[model samples]
Target chain A: MAETTRASDPGTGTATPDAHTAPLSEFDRDTAVRRRARGEFETVIADGWSVFGAVNGGYLKAMVGRAVAETLPHPHPATVTAHYLTAPRPGPAVIRVETVREGRTLSTATASLTQTDPDGTEVERLRVLATHTDLTAGPDEVRTTAEMPDIPAYEDCVGMDLAPPEFLRDAPIVHRLAGRLDPDCVGWAVGVPSGRAGTRGWFAFADGRPVDPLALLMVGDALPPSVFDLGLSGWVPTIELTTHVRALPAPGPLRVALTTRNLAGGLLEEDGEVWDSAGRLVAQSRQLARAPRG
Target chain B: MAETTRASDPGTGTATPDAHTAPLSEFDRDTAVRRRARGEFETVIADGWSVFGAVNGGYLKAMVGRAVAETLPHPHPATVTAHYLTAPRPGPAVIRVETVREGRTLSTATASLTQTDPDGTEVERLRVLATHTDLTAGPDEVRTTAEMPDIPAYEDCVGMDLAPPEFLRDAPIVHRLAGRLDPDCVGWAVGVPSGRAGTRGWFAFADGRPVDPLALLMVGDALPPSVFDLGLSGWVPTIELTTHVRALPAPGPLRVALTTRNLAGGLLEEDGEVWDSAGRLVAQSRQLARAPRG
Candidate 1:
């Protein structure tokens, strides 16, 4: 009955009466925005893109990135930072982008994602500042001191979609993407905990869509909080997140490593690095978030 | 002749006509902002707090932080991200702050530092988004998996102020603060590049002022770019910087470690960690900057 209902569900809408029509990729469709006016866009915060009732911060950032990318002359977001003012539910949202500075090499813009409350009051959910540039035209020099995180091969890792834990069974977002966690990093899933603060995994869209600069934002925060490995459980809300797109990712699953260094004064800082299948460092992110209750 | 004129230099202004008067610490006086109106402030970007010709990014951030802290109910800036639109020289500037959200545990604000150009056009130099809260009221739990960067004792390190480098002699900002760098990290100074991208040092104000939350902002970007150790040269301009204040520093010189993990496509991401004398993590920062023209 569940599988039959999913076929006709309006949220997925993958099966239509007209069998000849093709459907959009989940990422592209959910992140799509329509221009309302000059520098203004409207989009819906689609279902199944949320965690623990609130829309995922990175997914919201990707939506804003799409709006900012459209308004700028550049083709990609080079560096972006978003501050979560308040979490919004699955509903309609308005993104307003303002050009801060448009240089020949790089252009900077500010975007605000706002949603209206039931009481007819509009509240801003997320505020973003991003600089966009054409990655192909950027300098070709490559030098890196950071190494790609060492993790088990995709086939050797534990597939999250195969059997998600009880707590994550209600999280539709987890099912939307295919993820494989490092065995050592998932000790907390069992009765034993690692007592460390780090998570390494490989990720790709469930629909096998190609990842782009905008998609990198979502990948940055897609994993479970690193603190979970240390036996801490609860929702870890991000206060501010910053992502630097180092290069356009190559095809294939992206490898990600999230590590928390300092957890003090009720706050913790998590640093993440994403490497493409080609073993190229594609993106880096750091976020400050409130510690979990437990 | 230079010694005789130093006493009357207005930039330092430590020697005044009234010898009995005490002077404000450089960190305090330089970051001071006067309220001009509601949610508005005016402050000067002092001359000594600059590198090359442009004012330092961290110093500018500290000044903007002061304004944001004043308007919010919170006392300390918990997390702040600043995007440098354009580097401003030493001059008077205006800071405009707006309260975005005032929650029970945290308050969020946005600040803009604008200065009038010689053409009489007002230009925004720096834009910042910060969340503030009282660190003392935060959760007492502490869990850290990151270890402090190991370096020799402060007395064994190379004092940058003792024999200033030729390139740094003109940079007054270096002299305003005393720094001792690890010998291994300063191989680039003598033309023997280490081929590594890391720098560890001890830092404190030249006037012996205690480091505070605001000063941590300056220390985040105080050291020379870590790429210098890799034989890179030229001024590395910061595009966007995010600093998380984990805790207030315990009195004494700060132990700072700056490391660049990746440098690609004419941009690099540098991560910094600041540990106070009490061996507590005080701040963590990550910045995306343009690669130096070597």
Candidate 2:
């Protein structure tokens, strides 16, 4: 009972990729993005693949959204932008794709993810820029003027246990939080606060797999930064990111919200939303970080 | 009277790039992103440089942040990510720069902006991924748990005059609305709208130019989108865009909101906020549009 999987457990949501609880070979060896054979599309970044150590810009933007969803024929991923040039180390990474407008319905690619050196020479790090479509028809015209924050019903919030390391302590992303968070962002990230700058609850992954759209594009930088509740902390990284899926997420436990109003100078801006336990409003995100240096 | 230039008229905040207000040689020839002599940094996608007619992913991420602020020695542009790959049609758009991860303090570049097909072959359209720092120090720590959205002060908003042709009705950015918006996304958008989406006020640049951080990166896609208040209209392009500058905005009228919760399938997600009329909170954006098709 991953906490009794809720929102009435619609469709029983099954992600079907269990090598042993959603390992799907680290999403096909380090997050879904493929195309290596010396043709730009690699991933190995495994050495903790961190969050406070660096290597979690949504798991390298799901390795550039599975390398722009394998050069898009169309499976859905409408947008994904990542630009975190520095802080990237674990090992073996190369994702140099670039199609830029593939169209049928819609497609666009640009994957960089470098850092191969050893005379193999690569060294870039983050530059995912994407867009792929086929959102299952759905929009002739739909409407929503922004409204999905009224939380407190993921069985009534509050439940978090994050530690990262036991080989990522079973990483795929599975935060239940909502006792109002921001103890310096998931610092034993407890929960229960929606006063405003943000935090809403429940998200699934550690093998409970379900949400898709490239794992909701790694759940939009996977939380912990609503600018650490204004006091400012360390390892804030994440230099650039953009995600927008809009629909195709409705399984179990997805309702997330991680907001931020703004932070200047050292620059910080964050915003996110993901509603799915049948609530709809699938994905939306915002990023730009820098704080925790000197 | 530029409508009394508000927020109690702070320092008369005028960016002075006049040729009749921030003409700025069209941002050094098509949006502040220079470096061309056939070396490889270019910009020419003009012919109305659209917003609904296409070609405005923040003016191609300010032409990849003026070509990564001319290969980063740092003049500022800490982050700018654009990923639109379609709707490109107005000519000579080349911006191929890639200096990923350069750091003395911070620098990351990756401009692709192509579209050179006559016979030579290039075709890329958009992919500006940047981060260049040295924003003149001054950040050891700052605090602002997010708060700045109580707008409607800029002379009380509502003063728009859009035409979209007088060579894009003089576009170098200039909008003023807060008389409560959605007039059809800054309206004068002319006709059709009964749905509901978003819109907010006060933004400047029509040579008013006094909001730097690269013009707050073109005021995060310079308005006219909230999906035309859901009645749904054309030119909602913007395939992907990410901007986050945060603070440096202080001159005059700056307090924008522009929201959109979700618009599913045809896919839409817009979120923007810029508040600096001495109010603080400077640049934050989100884009992933596509709702003008059928």
Candidate 3:
């Protein structure tokens, strides 16, 4: 469903099929498909009207990596930091990528996406840094992280859940990857594309659907809280997401062992490490998420 | 020497002492020390009468952590992020720290400092989050990191000839722990408190002046170029510093292995893992540093 901009103001008017009676399409107007010779990925966005309560910062970051991979390299890793200048959209935007360096051992690339109003005023801008490197056996540093906490299965978790847009049902990939979101339980995750160092995966929800790589990344942003949402209960919307993939594991189910380090007076943070099927450290992510709730 | 304000409007004025020219005896007047104890760590301020060509966001972050440590735990590791609200003072300002959580394994804290106008209007605000944890040799989940990079001696770097702060020159602890700042070179470091798991030595300037922990932290922050700065002739200021100390090594001669993972467009990050003489991993750190021209 393409949004029809009011010919007068591009920012006004939605391309909804019906004013009030129709359900919106799963493939909303913001959905666009990128078909590259090497790789093809589809992108869907919110025009500031987030599927979740807030615009998804992690989704945009993961998309930048995905977009770069189309013309760059596969099975690559990236360390991305996106400065959220403005809230992203649920509508279509352009993602452009350029190669930076490609050595035998490593490759680098840059990506940016932007959205503008009909008058050309900017709405969003996203910059990404990604790298692809060869897999080599290291001096063999290995550390076994905490065990995955026992939690209800996905089926049971789904039954107990309640939240916004139900786009997750179609994105089972993220759920299988991130697993259940039990703040109190440990999540066990491992990297896919095994043998490559520094890669990890998690199960998450997307637009209320099962989580995939992008969704998992988007929802995984947790930080210590402040007074911004002083009266709120639970985690705050993540304002930013910075992640690094250290190892890539073989394609398989993974586990992410998560535990909260501290939360008090409306601020909290957690220490999470992702492991591969063999229990190897694929990646370690520590986010300054919002304060855990009562 | 404290500034004395008359009974005037909050927009009042008073003669503040020259922070730099003041003797060490009046150490409280040093803006850096005062800021470390109570100023904003990092913020984006509208250009004004500050001294540095570019306002330093890095120093604020490091200093805020030090300020928080006074009220938290000693020698605790912190992973903090400061959202740049406004540019910081090239002049003087105060900082404040708060303990958010004091857990058994870790402690969480927040610090914020505001820079104000002579009229007491706000200029900028810095928010910081720090975490402290007790070290334990739990179950042997062993993992090794990349072998330490090989480099030259402390005396060989290009920056050595450049002038360093006089305090740095007199502080044998900084020299013994981090070596003189030259260009990219490897140096040996150890905790000042011998037998502790961290690098040690008395680092304050030659005159036995009070030391600032923020200064001590930066000593070990000297890292080689991120691949981005490898061929470029410039320097980068870190935007954030995240340090994790697993165990306190018996303080004595400690070693810091520094290396860089370069990003495109002069964006770079550095990672360092500290080890005891026995090669036990004492702590590790990652910094979001900028790439600056030499």
Candidate with top lDDT is 1
RMSD (Å) per prediction: 4.9, 21.3, 16.3
TM-score of chain B of each: 0.91, 0.32, 0.55
What does candidate 3's lDDT look like per residue over A1-294, in tens digits?
222211112112233347377553332222334754333344566443233345455556666666765566544453443433345655666776656445454455555667767798754455444554433422243222234435444344421123223644433222212234333221111112121112122333222222223322333342112211222233253423455454544333335544333232232333345444454445444443434343
Interface RMSD of each: 1.0, 7.0, 14.7
Task: Give model 1's DockQ, 2 decimals.
Answer: 0.77
Cα lDDT of model 1 by residue, B148-251, tens digit: 88978877888676555665766877666767899989988878889889999987776766777877876779988899988998889999888888898877
Model 3 off-target regions past 4 Å?
A: A1-43, A46-51, A71-74, A98-104, A135-178, A182-219, A222-235, A250-253, A258-270, A289-294, B1-173, B176-294
Which candidate wins on DockQ?
Answer: 1
Q: Per-residue lDDT for A1-294 in model 2, tens only?
A: 244442123335465566676545334455644575543766677654464456677877876777677777887887777777766777777777766666778777777777867787666777776778888865545667666767766544444443434523544233322122223334323233333455555666533456678878767666566555443445777777777787787667687788766555666667788878767778887777765552
TM-score head-to-head 1 vs 2, winner: 1
Two-way lDDT contest, 1 vs 3, winner: 1
| Model 2, C-alpha of A165: deviation from truth (Å) | 38
Give residue B240's error in model 2 in angstroms: 7.9
In model 1, the Cα lDDT at residue A28 comes to 78
